[model samples]
Target: MLRAENVTLSYGAEPVLEGASLSIEAGQFVSLVGPSGSGKSSLLRAIMGLQEISDGRIETPLQSTDIGILFQDDALLPWRTAIENVSLGLRLNGRDRGRAVAEAEAWLERLGLTGLGRRYPRELSGGQRKRVALAQVLALKPRLLLMDEPFASLDAIVRARVTQDVVNLVESEGIGVLLVTHDLEEAIALSDVVYLLSNGPHAHISQRYSVPIPRPRNLVKSRSHPTFAPLYERLWSDLSDVVDGPRRIRTAA
Candidate 1:
C-alpha cells in the first residue's frame, strides 16, 4: 500500500539517507534494520512526512489519517485512562463518544487489555502501556503502521510476548507494517522481508532478504527454524560490514 522510490533525506546539507527505497503491501510485515546512525528512524520520518525528502518520492494511496505510528515512548496521556486514550483519536476524527468508547473497548480487549482499560498509564506496567499505545493506533483502523522500536524499552520476555501480540493483531487486522528496529532476531521473527540499510552519512538500502521461515510465526520457536540461523548470520555479516567498512578501509590504507 506504500512505496518509497529512490528517496533521499537530509538535514541542512548533510544527507541522512540517499536512494533508499522500500515498499509494504497490505498485510505484509516489512522491517528495516541496520547499525545505529544508519538513518532507520529518519527514513520513517520521511515516510510519515514529518521529514522532508530531498529527492525521489513516496507514494501511498492512503491519506495521512490512514497511517498509525508507535514510537519507543508510549506517548499516551498520563491522566487519560487506557480506554480514554485509545478512543481519543476516533473522537478527534468525529466519531461519536459512545461509538469511540465501544471501539476502543473492543480493541483493548483484542490486545488483551480488557478490564484494565480503566487504569491510567502510570498505573500500567511498561508492557501494558505499550499495548495501550498499540491499541490507540490500531483502534484507528489504519492501513499502514510505522513502528520505531516500539518494544525496545521492555525486557526480553515481555518484548517477546508484546511482539507476539503485535504480530497476531496486525495480521488479523490486515494492516501493513514498516518496523524500524535494531533487533535482528525480532526482524527475522516478524518480517516477511527484511531490508538492511548501510551506515550513513548517505545511507541506502543495501540488501533485501525474503524470509524463508513460514508463518504464522511463533517468535521464540521460529528462532530454531533451520533457515533462521543462516539468514540471521548473513544479515549479521552484512550489518557488520556496513558498520565496520570505513574502519576497515582506513586500516587497509
Candidate 2:
C-alpha cells in the first residue's frame, strides 16, 4: 500500500540515505534493521513526510495516505490522560467530540487499557503508557503504521505480549506496517519480510529476506521452530558485515 522507490535524503551536504527502497503491502509486516547512523529513522521520517527526501519517489493509495507513527518513547503528552491522547488525533481531524471520545475509549479497551483511560502518562507504568501510545495511533485508523522500535522500552514479558497484540491487529485489521527496530529477534518474530541496511554517511539497503515462518506465529514457539535458528544466523551474518565500529550491531533508538 506504500512504496519508497530509490529514496534518498541528505542533511545539507551530508547524505544519510541513498537508493533505499522498500514496500509495505496491505496486511504485510515489514521491518528495517541496521546499525546506528544507518538512517533507519531518517528513512521513516521521509516516508512520514516529516522530512524532505533529496531524491526518488514515495507513493501510497490516494484515499488512505494518512499514516500513523509510533515512536520508541511513546511520545505521550504529560498533561493528557490516555484517552485524551488517543482522542487528540480524531479531534484534530474534525471528528465529532462525543464520537471521538467514544472511539478513543474503544481503542483504549482494545489495547488493554480499559479502566486506565483517565490516567495521565506519568501515572501509568511504561507498558501501560506504551499501550496508550499504541491506542493513540491505532485510533487514527491510518492505512499504514510506521513504528520506530515501539516496544524497545518495555520489559521482555511486556514486549512479548505487546508484540502478540500487534500481530493480531495486523492480521485482523489488515494494517500495513513498516517497523524500524534494532532487536533482531523481535524483527524476525514479527516481520513477514526484513530488510538490512548498511551503515552510513550514505546508508542503503543491503539485503531483503523473506521470513518463511508461517502466520499466526506464536512468538515464543516460533523461536523454537527448526527454521528459526538458520534464519537468525543468516540475518546476523548479513548485518554483521556492514555494521562496524563500537556500534557493530547496536543501532540507535
Candidate 3:
C-alpha cells in the first residue's frame, strides 16, 4: 500500500497543506476531489517526490514503487516526435536509445497512437496529445499511476473517451490509480472510491465514498441505477459543505 501520514506542503511561511493524509492500497483506483487551490496537485507531487512536504511523511512500498504521473496538459516536448517523448524517461534511465524507441513505439500502439508516433505535439489534437503523454508514462510500467485532472481541458466526448482509455489500460496492467479531478462524474465513473478533501492549512479527510458500483463502470448506467441518486446526492451534499465553506465555489464551472 502507498501511505501518507500527516503530510503537508507550504510555500515559505504560507501553508498549502497541513496534516493532510490518505493511503491508497494496491489495485485500488481512487479519486481526490476538492475546490480549486486545495493542494490536490501539491499532494500528488509530494507523493511522487517531485515536491517536498513540510510537515509529515509519504511512504511507498519501496523506493522504486514505479510511480507514473500524468499532468493536466499534454506537456510533451515540442521538438520531439510523440514516440520520442514517451521514450524519454526510459532513455534517462539508461535504456539503449534504440531499445527505448522500440518500447515506446509498442506502448504507442497499445495506447491508440500507432501510426501517429511520428507526429509532433503541435500536429496532434488535444486528446491525441494527452493520449501520447499517457502512453509515454505507461511505457515506464509504473504500478502506481498519478493523474492531476488529466481530462479537465478536453471536450465532454473526448474526456469520456480518454477516461475509458485510462480505465481500460490501467486495469489491464493491474496498475493502481490516484486521480485528482474536479469532474464529479469522472470521479464516479473511474474511481473505486472517491476521497473528498477539505481546503487547507489544516486540511482534513472529509469523506470516503466507496463507489459501491460494479466495474467496467458505465456513466450512463451509473446515472440511472438504484444506487446512483442517493450516492451522488450524498457526495454532492458533503462536498457542498466544503465547497461552499468560507466563501468558495461549490460546483465546477
TM-score for all predictions? Answer: 0.97, 0.93, 0.92
Tell me the lDDT of model 2 at 160: 88
Best by TM-score: 1
Q: What digit string (tens of lDDT, one per residue) describes model 2 on residues 19-42? A: 989988887889999988889998
Q: In angstroms, what RMSD does candidate 2 have relative to the true structure?
A: 4.1
Residue 35 CA displacement from its true place in model 3, Å:
1.0
lDDT of 3 by residue, 23-100 (tens): 888778999998777788899988888998888888887455389899988799999999889889889878999999
| Model 2 poorest 10 in a row by lDDT | 244-253
Tens-place lDDT per residue, model 1, 126-232, is 99999999999988889999999999999989998999999888878889999999999989989999999998888989999999888687888889999999999
**Model 2 TM-score relative to the real fold:** 0.93
Structure candidate 2, residue pairs in collision? none
Candidate 1 achieves a global lDDT of: 0.92
Please list the residue runs of candidate 1 whose C-alpha ends up more than 4 Å from where it truly belongs after superposition. none
lDDT: worst 10-residue window of model 1: 212-221
Best by the lDDT measure: 1
- What are the lDDT figures for the candidates, one per model? 0.92, 0.87, 0.84
Clashes of each: 0, 0, 0
* Candidate achieving higher lDDT, 1 or 2: 1
